[model samples]
Target: MRAVVIESPKQLHVTTLPDPTPGPGDVVVRVAGVGLCGTDVHMLAGEFGPTVYPVVPGHEFSGEIVAVGSEVQGYAEGDRVAADPAVYCGSCHFCAIGRGNLCEKWGTIGITMDGACAEYVKVPAANLYRLPQGVDLGHAPLIEPLSTIVHGLDVVAPSVGDHFLIYGAGTMGLLYLQTARRNGAASVSVVDLNADRLAVAEQLGADHVATSADELDRVTTGWEVVVDCTGAVPAIEDAFTRVRRGGTFQQFGCAPDQEQARFSPFRIYNDEIRIVGSMAILHSYGRALDLLAKGWIDSDTMITHRFGLDEYQKALDTFSQGTGRKIQIVPSLAPGA
Candidate 1:
C-alpha cells in the first residue's frame, strides 16, 4: 500500500507500506477521497496538540470496503461507506450519557491512530455508514465537516426570521450561513478577512458580507445569534460583545491551545446571554449524509482543488496559500499519473 506519511513537522513523504488487514469489528477501506482540513495543516505545523509522528494524516474520507472483520455483521465487501473518525470507548461516562464526542478515551483516526491518506485504511465497522447508491465517492468525504455544522446549528437553534452574524467565511462559516438560511434565518451576515471567501459566503446566501469587524455597522449589531468560525481569539472575544442581550453566541471553532480571550463577566450576567461551545459532531453524521444525499449541501462548489497521492506537497502548499475553498487528495492516482 502507498501512503503519505508526515515524518515530521513541515515534512511529507509518499512511501510504500504494508496493507492493513481488518481486525475484529474493523473494516479495511480502499481510500477514495480525503479532504484536507485546518487540523491537518496545524498538525503539519506542530501547532495541534500531542500528535504522534509518522502518522498518515487524514480523517475526512470515504471509500469502498475491500475487507471486513470477522465480527462485523452489518457491513460486507464492496460496500461504499463514509467513516466516523472519532473512536470512543463505549463504556466511558460521556459515552454512557450519549455524548460520545467527548468520550474520556477518545482516540481519533488520523490524529491518534493511522488515518486515511493511504491505499487502504482500517476503521471500526461501527463507524461506517453506507453511502447511498447515487452519492459520488468524491463527495462522501464532506460528511464529517458538514456534520459538525449541523451539530452547531442544532445547539444554537436559530429561529425563523432571526438575525445571524457569522464570523469567518471559510468552509465551516459558509456552511453555517447556508444552514442558518435553511433553518429560516431572515437576515445573515458573514465576516472574514479574505475578500474571496466573503464573496463565496454571499453566493451561499449571506445577505451581507464584510472583510473587517469595524464594517459591522449598527444594523448588524444585536444579532439574535452570532457564530465564531475563525477560531481566532480576537474573533471569539468580539462575538461575546456583539451578540444581542439574551441572544446566543456559538463558538464553533477550535483555537490554539495557549490562546486566551477575555469578556465582560458583568455583561454576561446582566444581558442573560448564552455562550455555547460546540465541539466535534455529536450524533449528526447520519443527518449530514442524508442532507448530502438529498443535495442540500453542495460539495462540488465547495471543493476547489484536487491532487493525487503523489502530489501531497502540492496539495499542502495550495491549501496553505488559501487560494480556493476546499482542497481534496485523491489517494489513488489516475492512469499515467
Candidate 2:
C-alpha cells in the first residue's frame, strides 16, 4: 500500500508498505477521504506532542469496511463508516468518570498510532460508526472535527438566546457558526484575519464578521459565548477578554504547547466569567454523526479541495497557505501505483 509516511520531523515520504490487517478487535477500512487540518501540519512539523514519527498522519477520515475482526459484530464488508481516531486507556481515573478524552494515557489513531492516510488502514471496531445511506463518504471526514466542536459546545453549554462571538473563520470557525445558528444562538459574530474566510462565515450565517472585535462596534454589551477557535496566542487573548459578564468562554483551538497568554484573573472572579477547555472527541461522536446524517452541515461549502495519495504534499501546501477550506486526500488510488 502507498501511504504518506512522516519518517521524521520536517520529513515526509510517499512509500509503499505492507497493507494493514485487522486485529482481533479491529476492522480494515479501505480509505476514501481524509481531511487535512492544522493538527496534521503540526504532526508533520513534529510540534504536536505525542506525535510519533514514521507514522501516518490522517485522523479525520471515512471509508468502507473491507475486512472485519473475528470478534466484531454488527459490522461487515461493504459497510461505510467514519472512525473516531481516539484511543484511550479504559482504566484511567478520567475514563472511570466518563472523561476518556482526558484519560491519563490518551492517544489517537493518526497521532500516536498508524492511521488512515494509506489505501488500507486498520481501525478498532469500537471506533467505527457507519455512515448514513445518503451521507457522502467524501464529506464524512468533517464528522470527526464536528464531534470535537460538539464537545466544546458541551463544555460551554450554550443556551437558547446566547449570542456567540467566535475568533477564526476557518473551517472550524465556520462550522462553529453553522452549529450556533442551528442551536439557537441569537446572533453569531465572527473575527478572522482572512477576508476569504470571513466572507464564507457570512455565507454560513455569521451575523457580524470582522477582522477584529474592535471592528464589531455594534456588539457593545459583549457576547454570551466567546470562543477562541484560532489557536494563535493573540487571537486567544483578544477573544478571552470579549466574553460578557457571567458569560462563558471556550478554548476550542489547539495552540502550540509552549505558547502562553495572560487573562485578567480579577475580571474572571468579579464578573463571574466561566473559562472552559475542550480537548478532543468525547461521547459526542455519535451525536456528530447524527447531525451530519440530518444534513445540519453544509458539506459543499466546507470541503474545497481533493487530492489523490500522490498529491498529499500538494494538499498540505494548499492547506498551509490558507488558500482553501477542508482539503481531502482520496487514498484509493490504482493498486500498486
Worst 10 residues of 2 by lDDT: 328-337
Give per-residue lDDT, candidate 1, residue 78.
94
lDDT of 1: 0.86
Model 1, which residues run further than 4 Å from truth?
8-11, 216-220, 334-337
Task: At residue 253, give the lDDT of candidate 2.
Answer: 85
Model 2 stretches with alpha carbons more than 4 Å out: 333-337
Error of 2 at 215 (Å): 1.7
Q: Report the C-alpha lDDT of model 2 over 88-146, residue by residue, as the tens digit.
A: 99999999999999989988988889888899889999999998898999889999999
The residue pairs that clash in candidate 1, if any, are none
TM-score of 1: 0.94
Q: What's the true lDDT of residue 87 in model 1?
A: 86
TM-score for each candidate, following the candidate numbering: 0.94, 0.96
Q: Write down the worst ten-residue block by lDDT for model 1.
A: 212-221
Alpha-carbon lDDT of model 2: 0.89
